[model samples]
Target: MKLFRSKQANSLTELVKACQKQDHQAQVQLYERYKGRLMGICLRYARTEAEAEDIFQEGILKIFDRIGDLKKPESVDSWVKTVMIRYAIDYYNQVTKGQKQLISTDYIETEWESDDYQNLFSKLHTEVLLETINELPEGYRMVINLYFVDGYSHAEIAQLLGISEGTSRSQLLRGRNLLIKKLDLKGVKQHEKF
Candidate 1:
């Protein structure tokens, strides 16, 4: 039982130790605990649920393969997040095939400070939102997801998508307009209380 308890200094020591010893049950426990959050993270970058699931699985495999290289156990969450983000960027690169230019994110600020962000998301089913996003044209969908879903700035999105900052901004504007039209929310002011 003590072996199952991670060292106090190392947040991920228990999971890491279990994985190292090929403890399937421990691995399953870890997966169950983190699956939802990681999926949410992956969903922002993936164009579809199928793709997001694939990314999630790949990210877990990456964790398994690279956990041994982690010098600090407590940093497990951050480490996993880094791997996931990198995987998404790589996937985007592979899928887009050099269509986007990497842009910067120094000036993009989000206005979603109200609790409404959570409430709005709760009211809007994930599947519906995803379907709507999937319906967007390739470039618009990617920019919108990266900016709003993944919390990347226009600059970061431009860089990630290999487009100019202006292009990223334009795509985001276009994506939002398309979404409003699709969802029938045209003429509504930005930040209007739902």
Candidate 2:
């Protein structure tokens, strides 16, 4: 039986083969192809560019080391994404293990007044939003970054932070309210509208 290979699949298979064989040049090419998307993922999970770069390096290294374990060549991008997320969560879990504190329910229950953000994300550049998020206190920043920027659900953030989903949701809501206050106080207006 003649096996048919689509052009993209053939290329991916070749890349995977090279990766499995420890071809440095092929690995570089693969990294170049996905670095931006991967770095964006890293940025969402990380607090700083340096930290994101560190995670990016670690994630790619893991990908290269485990290339042999990837059963399907076409799923490499998704695989990388999953690895990045897991690595991010691992980093967070390690950093926050003993620092997990129960914030007051009164603070968590503070009625947030940022429903406008729900409709305003597309209006603001993600970079601006990220900058605003970076301005948050460490705990609030991490929770919000994972929840809003990384697209992790509350349950996932709760699990990652060793907090309840209620805490995760409250943190996110409070973070959003705080962000809106910061933006408003800074007189920053959205350049575009969602």
Candidate 3:
């Protein structure tokens, strides 16, 4: 059975193999191939572009250090993504360690119909939506990104963030409310349910 058929897969397999053997050129190739996508994940977690760059660099270094541990070369993209996200989460936790009180215990209730919001969200440009998400407070942004964007469940988010599930739920709720408010302020009208 062949592991790689496409040129892209062959390239990826070769790159991973070379990286495992400590080939510097292969390391560079791997970084170049995935940097944009990894940087986008970093940006979702980072408050600033500089912070995202730092996370990206750190993740790349970790990837090079652990490239040999990867059992499946075909899953390199997801492995790289996981490494980058873990790095970003660690960075976020370190930066906000002293501000733990910011995770609000009080959950705010908002009338959020997913179907309605889906319709509303479909109308906004990607950049506009991202900007609105970025404007959220750090904790809120993290929960929102992990839950909504990254497709992690509340329990998964709680574990990743070292918080209780209830806290994760609260943060997600508040984050959604805040996003809706910001979108409304930006003149994004909610679709009226018939």
Candidate 4:
């Protein structure tokens, strides 16, 4: 088992090819290789680790199911990431379906990076920051994850989540404020920045 575990780290191209052919061992290896990355992506969008696990499990299955269609084995990393993100978006859409709050307003741009906050950020840890972000309201969290974490523009997020650009901007602003408040409340206690 130890040797197999070590072996899984080598030969990603071969791993992907074997996975494409539905080899069960290779499939397991592929999962082992990408599980942390897949789960990290899910965690950014999810409210809790459990929810992230649910998304991670679903995304992994989806990734394998479509692996056979992969054109470039070397590109599997990005391919899997794209699929996981899309699936997370689907999960968000389905969960937020009837409860969607469309707040239409001109973009409210507030600078979160004040000099005071910059000092705090310099001492903050990644886990603490992620926890703070996760504490945001569902809509706010989703928009924050999409826009900042996932690097999607407001227009792109609006299109992806079927919300208006104004709404996306609104959510992101609200999310940022909430995150700042949370961070302010929880000052750095022997914490070091990531």
Candidate 5:
């Protein structure tokens, strides 16, 4: 396993070097290797399949354009993911610019008991959870995706979305509450205290 891992990393390094030299075949190979994972990132950030495609394409172009700037070839996957996320945010901002706000100032508070929904969430399918998340209001969805799925800090989300850390926290809280309600409507039972 260690040998295979080293070989994989070495191959990736070679690929990055070739891509930096503008080798078309290496670029295609790199794209093919990363496209699926990057597409998943794009899909999470985009409301529609078409929009996701647009984001993915833009992200790929950015990656190609900036491949020479990559300092650590071993971290290429993470760098690619970061690029896709930035492109997704940019695309979202462009699409929603000058639009009515989707985030509500009115906050909902719920007392979450320990291990209250663990079993319920454990029993649910990933697809179901993803669908429920996608149904969230745009701001809620973005916050949830950035915070929960992508493991971005609230401070990072605030910077990404041009909001305060308090707003990011509020949005995350509200998004979770909305998710719980949706899960309840789907017949996932919670503890009586919930």
Candidate 6:
């Protein structure tokens, strides 16, 4: 499939093939296609726009550098996201190395999966919710993103972040509590306890 200037790549198979061959235009097209989505993942992990841009650039490079390793073009969207998520975790690990953020072990009795909390959380504007979660402490933010947003299991999160499963659970709990409290402070919730 020729990446002609007048038209778009017609299929994922074609795009992946051209990208694997280092076709510049195809690479640009790939970049353009996933920029918003991949950058959203980066921004969710990063504390600032500058940091998100840095992560986004790094992820794109990885995507380009390893595009040939992608065996199935049909899964390109998910594969690209996986690449970005792994890179984000690596970035997190590097930043947090040897700097253990102290975490409070308060065990809040809350069914995080219950519909009540989900409805409560859903009430906030998307921007407000993301900003609130972003402002959480590093450990809290990382675990929350991994578990809540990315659908990673606690065990998977533990392996990814190089922490114990218990630590993952605690971090997620703490993060959730902190996020709820922050939401409360913002007048999103008046008498909610979790």
Model number with the top TM-score: 5
Q: Tens-digit lDDT track for model 1 on 50-75?
A: 88888888888887787678776666
Q: Deviation in angstroms for 174 in model 2?
A: 2.1
TM-score of every candidate? 0.62, 0.72, 0.83, 0.80, 0.86, 0.83
**How does each model score on lDDT?**
0.67, 0.71, 0.78, 0.78, 0.81, 0.81
Clashes of 5: 0
Candidate 6 local lDDT, 64-121, one digit each (tens)? 9999999977677778888998998898888754577755554476555666566666
C-alpha lDDT of residue 38 in model 6: 88
Model 1: pairs clashing at backbone N, Cα or C within 3 Å:
100-161, 100-162, 100-163, 101-162, 101-163, 102-159, 102-162, 103-158, 103-159, 104-155
The better-scoring model by lDDT among 2 and 5 is: 5
Question: How many angstroms is residue 94 displaced in model 6 relative to the true structure, after the best TM-score fit?
Answer: 0.7
Stretches of candidate 3 exceeding 4 Å from the true structure = 1-7, 100-108, 112-119, 187-194
* Comparison by TM-score, 2 against 4, better one: 4
Higher-ranked by TM-score: 2 or 5:
5
Candidate 1 residues lying further than 4 Å off, grouped into runs, are: 1-13, 16-26, 69-72, 96-123, 185-194
Clashes of each: 10, 0, 0, 0, 0, 0
In candidate 5, how many Å is residue 13 off?
Answer: 0.6
lDDT of candidate model 2 versus the reference = 0.71
**Candidates 4 and 5 compared by lDDT, better number:** 5
Compose the digit string of candidate 3's lDDT tens values, residues 41-145.
Answer: 888888778888898888889888888999888778778877778878888888864574554433456676768666666666666677788778888999999
CA deviation > 4 Å runs, candidate 4? 1-10, 100-114, 188-194
Q: After superposition, how far is residue 55 of candidate 5 from its true place, in Å?
A: 0.8
lDDT of 5 by residue, 1-194 (tens): 12113248888999999999999999999998888778888878887788889899988999999999999887787788888899899888789645765665435687777786775676666666767777778888899999988889999999998989999998899988888777655535323334
Stretches off by above 4 angstroms in model 2 are 1-9, 96-123, 186-194
